[model samples]
Target: MQRPNVVLIMTDQQRWDTLGCYGNEVIQTPNLDWLASEGTVFDSAYSPSPSCIPARACLLTGMDPWNTGILGMGRGGERHMGIGFEHTLPGELAKAGYHTQGVGKMHFYPQRSLNGFHHTVLDESGREEDPRFTSDYKQWFERNKTGEYGMTDHGIGWNSWMARPYHAPEFLHPTNWTVNESLKFLKQRDPSKPFFLKTSFARPHSPYDALPYFFELYMQKNLPKAQVGEWAAMHDVPKDASSTDAWRGVRSDEDIRQARAGYYGSINHIDHQIGRLLSYLKGSGLMNNTVVIFTSDHGDMLGDHHLWRKTYAYEGSAHIPLIVKLPKSMGRTVERTDAPVLLQDIMPTVMEAVGLDIPQTVDGKSVIGAMKGRSAEARDFIHGEHSTCYSEEQEMQYVTDGRVKYIWFPRIGTEQLFDLSSDPYELTDLAQRPEHREQLAAWRQRLISVLEPRSAGMTDGDRLVSQAGKPFVKSPHYAERLARFPLPF
Candidate 1:
């Protein structure tokens, strides 16, 4: 019984339904579909937080954002929370006698020097917006540099909607560079021992710059139209929102169609890259011994409900794709499991699959049993949180049980409840309905019970004090600053 090698491949802002195996006929994700067919695909998987940094922290630490105090972005939050830089998944794997390496966007500070990995390739020199890194992209056009083209600035959000041209060489895209680096690492691996490699692709997140071939593939396909609802019109979205959704202001039938075309094209591009990586793995003789897990940090709104990005608790943003390929002992060939899982579960699951002891402090439960075809009670409930990002807004939390979802907006004192079974789009709010009051109370208590234990030890001094007196941020500039400097680590 030798320990298995682990390869955790993650993409930024990918939706669960984007893959061909997930019932999406327009996007061709042959590699991901193959992984799903050869492994266990958890139909319901979610991120603990909808935002990038917080969700990533949870993934690497196997703890909730609140538990790790990584509620926001930047070094400030990580430092404030006193989360030692050494407590990540790779660090734990390294301690357990496994070689750990990472490539692409891990999204942590000190972007270089193994956050936990024994080796990291294609590391960005600084934040994407840093002037030194600007030359990496050609269409970053300084005048149009809304600050979203690179990782350094959070001013402009990156998404398919803001399809900027790339002037730099094709290799500058993080996904391209990450896969190239990962292949290089694979070539140098020691076959006698187990290894843990995290290959993160930073495309499909935004500035949707794909090679012309990818875009061309989808340009000829007929994509689905955007989903919009009345409630979406009430909130003030950012300017880049219009870039992704041509109908943001015009709402013409044709505009929605065009947006969908471009969005699907971006996803196709991601799938092609994934296909390339998987082919290399199989050709290199690592496919049989390696356990490959493919998933995403969070999801994109992609014009769902008129919202263009993540951070919202809507299914379009919170739900993600999760596929795990275990060795023969773990079973094989597309057994669809109805297990309720979270992104945080990935850390523990990988450790368990590799025969390592699960850390007691980690909150996620290993799904090894489920992967082995054993029946078990699915998770009782999945929780998610969204702190202010690019906005000085009140904090929000969500809890769901696959059928119903409850969202708590503390700042506006408004709560939203959605019957996911009936309304998958989350277009209607049932909070004020008298018949649903009891259900609301039950869900609220469930949320409180789950959240109370995590907040029990917090002191008044540790509260998110900076957000107490500020008005809810509505400006994109303020939102950009918030993205660069998030709060209450």
Candidate 2:
């Protein structure tokens, strides 16, 4: 039998509930919904880390962030370590005689120019210091740095210029150039051999850039607002919960509603682009022989718990959309056994789909049997970790059995236990409650038992050294700031 082509479509900062199929009526994601119907949708998929780089590193390598050493944001630290192009999915696929290519944002740093893919089309532009990309907007403030004229800063204002131009589609944004490039590659690639193509869309991420049509679509609807009363009560949340500057100020009911509407608009915009890509694949005669997997790196906090970005352990940030479409065996979409799964499973699953050997170095298990409707043992628990961003301040670990979630924040000496079955929103913390102490301790012991063995030489604060023998540059600003505001851990 011939190997099936692999088309992995990933979006950045996309939440699990954004699709029409995921019980969301506000946003229209027809393509994603159709894909879900045609494939097995893992309702509860999660990223090991909520951040972009770390989560992506975990995706490509099938290893946890600690093992891969991609602990923080773009272009620093263990990134320089020799883990480059060698261990990536493209690298592995290339060895298996597949043509590998990537388009759009992979966030593999050194400007996405490295990596072993046969082709790379990077569409990211703008000054590196853009505030929309980081927490400190002031650091990127430069009067001379200008782009297509848009809004400017509004001093201490809640609903100001920052919120205008509410919707921009992924393709029209600078990153869209990468998508166009991918289209070109798809149109021109060799048709004889199987290919591994990753088309990533970077939108709904920040600056909330999208075309006017998407903006107009949401403008017609009255969006929902953040529940401020519910949010303020969450102040005791561990500081490292998904870091974002968007939720800093106290917002009125109307402001939160508009913000959520804008976020939905961004999601819809990406959905349209995905629809276009899927249509192209079908029209080009590539749909029948291809295995398509659609998912996201992590999720955004779009006012969930009043948080605006990833890094939190909440379902809004941890749970993601995972849909896999294999070539129909008898014109049927097989439903796999209901079980917990992790993003790490992707690498081996792809290998299995292509009949390749699962590498010992990869930590994920093959889900090909499950995808094919064959019964198989499923993962009992999924593990997730998030360390200090920019700075090594807060460290967190999570283990979940799909029904209960256990989180440990070592730096702050805080723990969170959520009975997902009862409280999916994670509004209440049961870690300190005496009645739940036994369950919490059991979860902690399981977390430690799983982690300690995997971490042979790993340390909480150890820097990952590159293959070239250079150490990762921990963000200088973050280190300095940590020294200033020492949290009581």
Candidate 3:
């Protein structure tokens, strides 16, 4: 059998519930929902790290973020750059004769760093910090639109409740440009070898600036109200908090409504753009030879629990929608699995799908068995973490097996446990309950195994630890390779 081409579609900060197939009743996502219906939808997919650079690092490298050194965004001078993984998914595929092209947010340092893709056209929205590389989308906007209007002219803060319709033509938006360039690569790619295309979208992350029609559609409709639990008071913002403050709680009910509407509007717009790529594939008769996968780097909270961004262990941050569609020639049908899988698994799964070798360096197990309708579980649980990005309190680690989740905040010595099967929204904290003490103890032991080896000192072999240990990061790729791509600022 000829190897299949691979198309991985990713969105930034998009929640798992934003697609129709994922039980999203309100969002307009016909095209994505169709893909889910045709493919195996892994219901418990999660990002190893619920942040941009780190989560993306796991996806590209198929290694844990602890080894990758992108523990968080690496912003604000404490760390200027991220670890450069030598054995990357695209690099491996490219080595194996697949022509790989990445479009949209490849959020690596030096911005121009190919990471692994043979070619990448970037639309890393609003990141001008990297003086080394000029954004292709920015230049295109200048070329076509005469740079008359910027994407952020509507005045919505990067992470705020401010909602507005896109001020310019829909074609000029970065979301469309991302797919536009990806389609261009598809159209021009060599036919002698199967290609790997990453059609990555940087929207729905924020500047929640949807196209006018999308905004109007959501603004006129009534969407689900934000979920606020009794335990969420800690995240509540004072009414006096700045409107543009990304970390402060959204104090107004009306403001949260606008944020949710804008977020949904962006998702719908992205879905519409995805339909364009699907249209092209089917029209060109190339759909028979390709496998399409869809996911996101992480998810937005959208006012849930009085929070707005990702990085928490909540479902909105950790859980991601994952769909994989095999070509009809492959004899696979629409199957769904609840086995927990991580973003890193995509690398091994794609390698397996195309009949390439799964490198031993890749820690993620292939979910091909799950995709093939095999009942065996892919993983018992998934472990993930994020460092303090914008907030000192955001540093945390989590482990979950889909039925339950445990989150530990290293900074505050806090623990939270949730029975996801019973409380999907995570309204109650089970960590303090006497009935769940044994269960919580079991999870903490699991966390000890997961973190103690990292030399984090957060846990001993048998219990949680307050302070201890030397750095255990032995990978030369972390600090050694990081020097090559110094922080651009």
Q: Which ten residues in a row have the lowest lDDT in candidate 1?
A: 457-466
In model 3, the worst 10-residue window by lDDT is 467-476
Query: For residues 286-384, could you state the per-residue lDDT of candidate 1 as single tens digits?
Result: 778888999898888766776666777788788899999887766554478766688889888888777777777688888777677665546878888
Best by TM-score: 3
lDDT of 1: 0.67
Query: What CA root-mean-square deviation does each model show from the true structure?
Result: 6.7, 8.3, 2.6
Against the reference, the lDDT scores of all candidates come to 0.67, 0.65, 0.81
Instruction: Put down candidate 3 lDDT per residue, 285-370, tens digits, no spaces.
Output: 88888989999988878788888778888998889999999888768754789889999999988888888888877888888788
Relative to the true structure, candidate 3 reaches a TM of 0.94
lDDT of 2 by residue, 294-404 (tens): 889888766656556677667877888888888874246565345667777898888877777777768777666666565556777888877554333234668897789
- List the candidates' TM-scores in order: 0.82, 0.80, 0.94
Question: Which stretches of model 1 miss by more than 4 angstroms?
Answer: 74-86, 123-160, 164-173, 236-259, 332-334, 373-375, 392-394, 455-489
Name the TM-score of candidate 1: 0.82
Candidate 1 vs candidate 3, lDDT winner: 3
